[model samples]
Structures are given as C-alpha cells and as structure tokens.
Target: MGRLGVPPLPNHALATRLADAYRAGTTVVLAAGDVPESLDAAEAIQDAWMASLGTSHAYKLGATIPAVREALNLPRSFYAPVPDDRLFRDGAAVPMAIARQTGVECEYAFRLARDLLPGPDALGEDEIAAAFDAILPAIEIPGTRYGRLAEYGGAALVADAGALGALVVGEPVTGLDPRALGAAPVRLSVDGTTVAEGSGAVMDGGAFGPIHAFVNRARARGRTLRAGEVVVTGSCTGYEVVARGPTIAAHFEALGRSVSLRFAP
Candidate 1:
C-alpha cells in the first residue's frame, strides 16, 4: 500500500517497458493497466527506471512556463534525470532513422560548481547564488517513447523522463551574472532561417529559477544536486517539430554563445 493505503504504483512493470524502449530506441504505447493515473505514480515509475539504469548523468526541466503548464494540465514544471548516452556535444549528427517526429527547444544549461544540498533550515540567497560554475547555450531534442505523445498529459511526460531524447550543448559562458541571464534574448534557427525567438525570462524568472525549485523539491525527497552535474532549465523559445532534414541552432546572443545539431535520417 502507498502512503494513504492506495496500492503502490506498478512501477516495476512500467519501468521495464521504459528501460526496454530506451535500449531499443523505439516507441511504446502503454495499455490501460500500465498507464500511470497520478503524478505520484508517474514519479514512482521514473524513479524505478532510473534505479534500473544504474546512474543519472544530468537533469532536464520542462513545461516551466505557466501557459505551457496550463496546456498540459500540470500544476508545476517537470524534470527528468537523463543518462550520459544522450548528452551530445555541439555539431554531433543525431541519427534519426527510427524517429517519426522530434521537437527542439532552446534554453540555458547550468553546470553546478558544488552540490546544492538542503540545509537544516531554508536556503539563503548566497547559498543559491554560489551554486553555479558556468552557463551554456543548449538546445534540447525532447521526445517520447509513447505514441500520440500530445494526448498524454504531464504525468505521462514525467513518466517518460520529461520526454528527453538528446541534449546538445555549446561552449560554456562564464563570469557573467547568472541572475541577469533572465533578460538575455535567445533565437532558434533552422537551416539558417529564424523559426522562433524569445528570452530567458520565460523560464520561470531565469535559468536559476527552475534550479532553485528542483533543489528544494529534491531535498524534500532526500536527494541532492551533486557537484559537476548539469541542470537544463526549460525553453526560452517554444519549440520546433522537425520531421526530417534540418540543422537546428540556438543562439544565446547576450552570452555570445550558440549550439547546433543536425538530424540525419
């Protein structure tokens, strides 16, 4: 039984399906019995998958914007612990032979200087400010293992590891005020043509906002954001659904950095 005597989530079966789909790089359409009906159940399934995967390499946050949350029927942002296998450097050609569709979004990716473990009391401003090492321009290629991806709501996304497919990072920009990043303008280009434009302010205040939220939330669950780990906050520009044959680029102009990847089918 769960905390309130509800039967515990059948995380094992679902996690196995998630893990198998990860290994096979294929889609999974969950049956009613395997589908998670609640956010708690979805989180349990994600944790189970992570446990089976052995270790996590990075964290990805999504659906941070209030409007986006409303569209997904989510009360808050979602996060996923991604494996290193999908963390690609800029200029890498991502093989998309099996993918039917993929979406790209741009954002700030922060590499932590030290662990951000919760203290006995509330975290102060200095503690939050000191947790950063550098910021990088990032474009996330978020995907799903399930069919009719949009029909599934936030809980389904949380279960599918925030729909994280791959993350491509550009050069890190340091020595800049992390708080000021919220005002930075970001542009997304496809095949050298602009497709989307926005600023970091859309990311729930800034790049660090989601980090702050995730820290407190994880700490409550007895987890810590360890040193040297990367936390990628949600999109600045919304997203582009790339069907095939396009080079996507994200430009974080204020920081003078950009990153890009090509989809090769």
Candidate 2:
C-alpha cells in the first residue's frame, strides 16, 4: 500500500494502456485475475487512469445499495471520477461504439456551488445538502472497456472510473425538500418500456447520503470535493443493462424532472 493506505499499483503500464484504449474508444481487457484486490490499489490505478485522461468534471458513487454491494461482493460503496468529455446534456446522442457493454442507472445528481475541502471530521447529510447549488434527475451510462465486469471484481470496476461511460443530466429541480427528496420515486425506461423502478429510499441516506459518503471517501484519499463539480449519487434503480437501442430515459417523479439519451447504432 502507498503512504495513504491505498495499495501500491502493481501495473502502471496496464493502467496507462487501458487509459489509452478509453481515450481511443476501443475495448481492451486485462488478463484473468489481473485486477487489484484492495481499495488502495484500485484507487491508485484509477488515479493513474484519470491523470492520463486529464481532470475529471464529475464524480460517481457505486454499490451504495445493499443489493448492488451483494451483487458486486463488495463490503461497501466506492467512488470514481468522470471525465469531462463523457458528460452530456439531457437528450444528447451517445454513440454505441464507445462502450463494450452499456448499462443505465437512474439517479439523483448534485452540482456543488461551494468547495467542500477535506477535513478531519465527516460532513453530515444536511451539510452535504447545503453545499449543493442544484439537484437534478440523471441517467448514468455505465460501460466497460474491459470484458466481463463480473470476472474483474469491484476493485477493477473502481479503477475504470466506476465503469462510467456517460452522464445525462436533466433540468434542476426547484423548491427542494430534503425529506421528500429522500423518499422520491424514480423510474427508468428504454424504448417506451419500464425496465427498472425504485425510490430514493434505496439510497444510503436518501438523495444526499452518497454526497456525504463521497466527501468522506475523498478526504480519506487526501483529496477535496471542489466547487463547480457534479456528483452523481448511487443509483435508485440498480444497474440495468441496455441493448443497442434508440433511446433511454429516467424520470424523477417527486422532483418533477427527467433525463434522456439517444443511442446511435
């Protein structure tokens, strides 16, 4: 492990090569059992990958729900950076060529108005909410440059930016109530059919829970949550794989907002 408690990266060349494949929009898979076993090692690989891509414009939390954690065999949640080029306005067209296996996540996303500097103490939910300038509906497109995500393990997923392919953010919701927002209902549909549905209650502490978790995680890694950065909380509807399709949509019922994406063949 590194001085910060993250494991030392065992394969810098592999990390750089994967980053290059991501940038080139090509699929590349590592040899079997080549993934990191510890969070620190995974974080180190992710840091290296992000450095090759340039600064991240947003962040995403993964495996926040019990079902997802169990599915990934993870004991807890994790965070990953999203490159700026991967963020898209609602209704943007996403080329299918960018990812090998595409999936969708319905989530609530926050855009921070003030910088959240790292400190010794963790921030509470209310404090996390106070830091956000806007709350919006979001559709997260998660994909893997690597083959068979389940074969690689959670640490490998973390290293590949939580398998983030793109983000589609909706219009900001006004008159936000923290309590109601936490319990808000969310649904995801593709090609006019409902594929997954759930509530904000599935989130760790409602909508703001993941933000607090993210802040603490960032601090643990000797980083800070900056202003003007968008943070996508864990999915309300678990990750649902998407076939090559024309469009995908997510609706935040209580928040009264929706986001959509069109996929190109």
Q: Write the per-residue lDDT of candidate 1 for residues 1-265, one digit (tens) a residue.
A: 1122224556677788888887787878866666677767787788777656656657898778888888888778868877777788898787874344568888888888887664434565557767887888888887788875655777878888878688888888889767777577899998889888998887687767777777666665556678877788888888778655678889988889889888887
Report lDDT per candidate. 0.76, 0.77
29: Cα error in model 1, Å:
1.7
How high is the lDDT of residue 230 in model 2? Answer: 84
- Cα RMSD, each candidate: 3.3, 2.6
- lDDT (tens digit, per residue) of candidate 2 on 34-67: 6777766777888777766767768888888777
Error of 1 at 126 (Å): 3.3
Error of 1 at 122 (Å): 4.2
lDDT of 2 at 242: 78
Which residue pairs collide, candidate 1? none
lDDT of 1 at 208: 73
